[model samples]
Target: MIITESLDNKPAAVTLEPLPDGTTWLYLRKNAKQVEADTGDETPDAKPWQCETAIGKLGADRSGETADTINAKFDDWWTYAAAWAEDEPMPTVQEQINAIYDTLAVMMGV
Candidate 1:
């Protein structure tokens, strides 16, 4: 089974294969989607990058409180992780995801 990770790099859709050792080999696949930036109620056009900023701690800033805030946030974090993976010293995949979740937890007060 293939897994598509979310913006936090949380792996999804896990699959397995039988190995000669009578053990199952686990496999994970990331759903790579073309990220599109938040158009802010406007139709986007003629932009190569979904986000305005390519390289940084996060791909985009989503400090806005809007109806599409969740979607925008997913894209923002997802793009940020992608960019961070491309260039810069980043934490482990698990760490990155944990950080995002932790932040969310704090924000949500859960």
Candidate 2:
């Protein structure tokens, strides 16, 4: 099965391969358009990120898991894990506490 979506405005595709070793491998094709643009070629020759996610413990049935749902999960997981790369670093412990206090104070009209 193949799932394609526009990741960060670049065409990306994810290939789901069910392996014989009871593991499902997810392959990611990232920056597909960038490769073509950089090479000045219409054909994309980007090497896909193979075996990005492996599902071994998961049962055979992927209950109600569609391309959109899987993509969203991958997006959220990547966002949280790769925050340092594209966005501001996560807040410090003190900053988090202060923000929580500020929000509470505003809610309580303090």
**Judged by lDDT, which candidate is best?**
2
The C-alpha RMSD of each candidate to the native structure, in angstroms, is 19.6, 15.5
Residue by residue across 18-63, what tens digits does model 1's lDDT show? 4454443333333444455455656564222211222222112322
What are the lDDT figures for the candidates, one per model? 0.41, 0.46
lDDT of 2 by residue, 28-96 (tens): 443354222233355356532322232212225653444466666776534432332323665999999
Q: Please provide TM-scores, in order, for all candidate models, with all chains considered together.
A: 0.22, 0.31
Q: How far is 61's C-alpha from truth in model 1 (Å)?
A: 21
What TM-score quantifies how close candidate 2 is to the native fold? 0.31
Give per-residue lDDT, candidate 1, residue 67. 24
lDDT of 2 at 70: 60
Colliding pairs, model 1: 1-15, 2-13, 3-12, 3-13, 59-80
